[model samples]
Target chain A: MTDISRDVDQQKYNQALEKFVSSVNGNTAFDGDFQGNIKPYQINQRMLALNVLRNNFPTVEKILGESVFTSLAQVYGKYYPSTWWDVNIFGDQFAEFLASQINSAKADAYNWALIAEIAQLEYAFIDRYYYPGHDSTPEVLIEFSHFDYEAQQLIKENHPNLVITYNCLDRFQSTANGEKFHSSHWSVDSSQKSKLKIFSASVFRQNFQVVSAFSCSTANL
Target chain B: MSSIDSFAGKQCSLGVEYMGAGLGLRFPHIYEILSQKPKINWLEIHICNFINGGLNQQLLYELSEHYPLSFHGVSLNLGGPEPIDVAYLQRLKQLTNELQPKLVSEHACFTSFDGRSYHDLLPVPYTQKSVEHFCRRIEQVQETIGRPILIENLSRYVQYSENEFSEAEFLSQLCQRTGCGLLLDLTNAYVNDKNLGISIDAFIDALPHQFIKEIHLAGFSTHDEWLIDTHSAEIPQEIWNLLELYLDRYHNVSVLIERDNNIPSFQELYNECCHAQSILDKYPS
Candidate 1:
């Protein structure tokens, strides 16, 4: 083939590929057999991001057992495979997908928030472990003061890689052992002056360890 | 949390085998892994909520007392334009200190950009700015974790115009500059090969094998001829061939199987592990 023809063919092929991708991704409507004449082996080459199944069937894990959950996931996977690369975020319309399924209402009856909260909790837990902290310098120290005192206290307490803004001051307490930091309350002491403090919060050795003391004085106390 | 044994030239915990291959330990299989005890060399603890909301640390400590762990995580969102989540980092550090994992891993993809989290590992244009930004984030992560991490290659659907470097070269440079290891996801590489018209061999050849500390193998389904790394299903034959190729070329490599959904029975997964082990045995390390 001539160079001009090859270029035209390549351009056409790219256009077809793009259209097929758009159709599968649900970006564009696909009325025809989108898989085309691709070989069965070739069909397996197409990518299906799990985000679609995750978002679509968040509670499938609870209503149905994991085995059934996965079988259902496969059905959805065939019908609405994700075209995006980020598998974790692909299942945006999963709830809608559930509603379309057999007895999906019953499944939806299950506390999705609980499932989501669990997933979020799980994600956050793993995230806290792999998360990295910033430099503990004096300049950087000032920025931490903007955080609420109760939060500061909590940081001083359980140095778990979690961000819980104190809902009340009852939540904060300095542990005697210096190793154990626990907080049941999230509220801050509004009366105590918001003083700057250099709290050394470390996610060291699989523990949320902290060493904190006030950096600035409170005139009230 | 609990005392673990330091094996010859390496470390070992009670139930956790350091045979090298790993899989992201998920909730569905928790009982199975603990009860049936599928023999995994390493268990990649997903770092989503291990250190949050006052979950009993003693349970995990007990698990660690019994098993050796390596952490695998999402939500780092390093490419997110917002300032690094310091609270997140602090919690991560605490967990790492507890686990003392063989290695911790995260995606090379950015989760958020410009402060708005897409909550996905979105692709970045392989530009000089991106390279520098990514390196800086990795440096910060290493500093926070007090150790380096292996950043996995992402399976992307789109390309950013800002990209100037090939994925391999970018990873090679990132490892060289930051002293970070590469979590080479063969399935992701295969996906990129189909999507981006890259030669898989050349892409592998570009990276120095020494920088590749870990390998990821998983099943992928297709959409419009694009191979998506979904971490569901069994490992595809093509990917197995690719794995064999990778093993043949790189020895002493730590490998893993990632099954996010369609989780089979522990027995079934053990069969898959055996398959992988046989391949590894052929090429040792």
Candidate 2:
């Protein structure tokens, strides 16, 4: 068997760094097995991953309640660190991370799922923002066809996150053909680029009314 | 001009082009920005959120036809040693092609390392090694987008003992080396001054100010005896004073007022923008 902790080289230094991170969250204890000084780069990477999780999942951070969340995120980051240039992709496993914590099973109705969904929505927004060729013209609308089955068949291709109800379908049927249906309209100014990707969903705010949620997606029409 | 454009214009009248004095557009204020139709110069939206299948697509067509917009990003992480996000850059390139924004900017700091991202804008150590890293990244980004990238100075609470040069020096070198423009955040300079114990003027003097494509002014907070760039409060008097000094020093500079948190009423922001306009007017070329 290859001795993983005995080598006094870059590989050993990397293992030591991983061990130090694991030790932060009680996963592994440091044994002073490696040689040389601690690297600033290692310290920075550990801190940055922890910070990304902390920022992206505010609710999880709240549930873990600061100290515990910080500690766990630090640990989780070491093991399943982000692989993307954008930090927004880091909190993908936050829901799973939260589930592993004590008293995690007793979260509120819109707790983990809500946060996960919201984070997903946030990520979708980011993805859409970065998506190219998002044409701003109304000519890109999906055709609603009563005669041709193939036209409305495209509904299956719509984003799964897009909230669709029998009522919405009925409303759409009621609207005249060739007329754009805007249940809710949010504007993006000229200086700004619009990249919403998720299909509209219903969100109930303080008003206790179901509201449409816009998606961020690829700009390519 | 439309009521919206005029309102946005009144916010930041550079007396030339209309990038407008704008606030970081958040989800909460979408209604107010649209309904009130306030005469603000421009609105800055996050590039990450704006292009995705959210409000950007839902409203962009209508909004773009009406008002001017700009992009402010936090995820570029230009100072990192890791490979840049090509997809993100591609999307940004597409968004810019569509939006044709007057200005698009990112921080001078690195937000990620080793693939994992730190969402906050973390400062880059001002050293020759870091400078080279940033310049190469900036060149890549600008090349990909086919536009000059405006790099903003970050407000850091902690200073690394290993940093060999001042922030301004590093920025000047980066611009000179990469041909990228500078987005001088005056408030960040103030924060660095207090926390890192550097003179504000010395920080200003070190940089080649003529290459500044834009300026960002925002408010900050103090925590644990350290000056933090929270972007959540009103611009402090001292920072505003510093801004005035900067405007006086650099004529014909495009300045922006950034309010990312604890955002006040639109009228209040417009009022503050008018103050910025008045300052710029006082130092007109």
Candidate 3:
């Protein structure tokens, strides 16, 4: 082909590819002027989205059950699309997506607030696992007994990364029902009636492992 | 002469040192590899995994101290319509400068378009226009990094109708135009042979042999009528035979045994490395 014709052909090829990508991103349907079949491409996009969600949100998947979770994830993937090069960040907006879904869900069927809280907790854990700041600084060994009360208060105020938030009431109920924290098998129980509460705890990383303090209310912080 | 005999006993002209048989480094095996210290010649790592400074960075630094490492990237998106990402390239350049790996490589495919990343290696159409586009981006990458990058052919399921050149011919011309090297992936060639009905031997022979700097051996899974490059299984006998053929032809090219999913025990992976080493041992390099 001549140089001009080759350029024209390549332009057409790029346009078709962009169209196909748009289809995968759920912006439009797969209708492009290309010679090859689009089914395989579609399959690849869905499989990738499913795999990434499966990796990042095992807890959410278990809570919603695999079938429902996967279907919801497929729809969420289409609307959100992947904006990051790293698959680690692909499901960053999943908690928000789940919250939106819960808002529209049947009120009498499931505990949407509890589900949304679980999603937020799982997303935070994943984010912290990959967060560079977690490993960037050396762990400070603060001796509370040696410090004055004012000094301790100053330290608590300055060390913001040490604080972790959780829904204490849900956690207590879930544990009473024989569920372990950070366990993927945990499911919400509708039988127990309790008020929702928030708590903050100081978390520490020693020897490359995370340890959380006993739960405390926001008033303590 | 038989196809294998045609290029037998020939020395590779790529000038890269023979690093012998190596394996891709994975997170699960990091501690075991460091503690046990397997008897492998070198290692290859996905550069993106170690781009951020953290536990992986610390582990990679220790691994580099023990073994000669090579960086293989998945997100260069060299064949995309947009220009190569400057910030990504700068990160890569910084990494290469710090690590000084023996060789650096990326796919001859695009992974992103229009500011959205698919996070998968999307195939480029085999056309003169594509060749020009890919070569221009590759040249830019090489200039930014201060080294020639090896481009690996992708395992493709679909072929565009406007392709003006065969994949092999396009790769050969790409190397000639951009001064890059080829990272010949035997499993991808084998998968394409099954799905696209292209002759593996012909495809291998058509490539510019002198430009082949490294070889990758991996396994693929079968999904219905298509052979997907899942990299989750053991090396098939057919792919092993193809690697042997390539080694017989080009004696100095480095070989990597890659397993990303369904990762086996370190001993099992080492045995595969030993298998490749046994072939390399026959060539008297």
- Which regions of candidate 2 deviate over 4 angstroms? A1-91, A94-210, A213-221, B1-20
- B51-79: candidate 1 lDDT, tens digit per residue: 54222343355456556777777778765
* lDDT, candidate 3, A73-164, per-residue tens: 89888888887676765788787777677556554455555555555554554454454433433222111111122322322343322343
Q: Hey, what RMSD does candidate 3 come out at?
A: 9.8
Clashing pairs in 3: none
Q: Give the CA lDDT, 0 to 100, for residue B237 in model 1.
A: 98
lDDT, residue B270, model 3? 84
lDDT of 3 by residue, B1-285 (tens): 543332331223234677889988886777788877877799999988777654456567778878889999998888889877787789789879988999999998888888778888887678767888888898899889988889998888767656778899999877777778899999999888888887888999899887788999998888777888889999989888887777767788789999988988888888998998888888867
Provide DockQ values for all models, in the order shown.
0.03, 0.13, 0.24
User: Per-residue lDDT for B208 in model 2?
Assistant: 71
Candidate 1 deviant stretches above 4 angstroms: A1-221, B1-18, B53-59
Q: CA shift at A121, candidate 2, in angstroms?
A: 9.7
For every candidate, give the share of true A-B contacts it also has.
Answer: 0.00, 0.19, 0.36
TM-score, chain B, model 2, is 0.88
- Model 3 chain A weakest lDDT span, ten residues long: A140-149
What is the interface root-mean-square deviation of candidate 3?
3.9
lDDT of each: 0.56, 0.59, 0.71
Candidate 1 achieves a global lDDT of 0.56
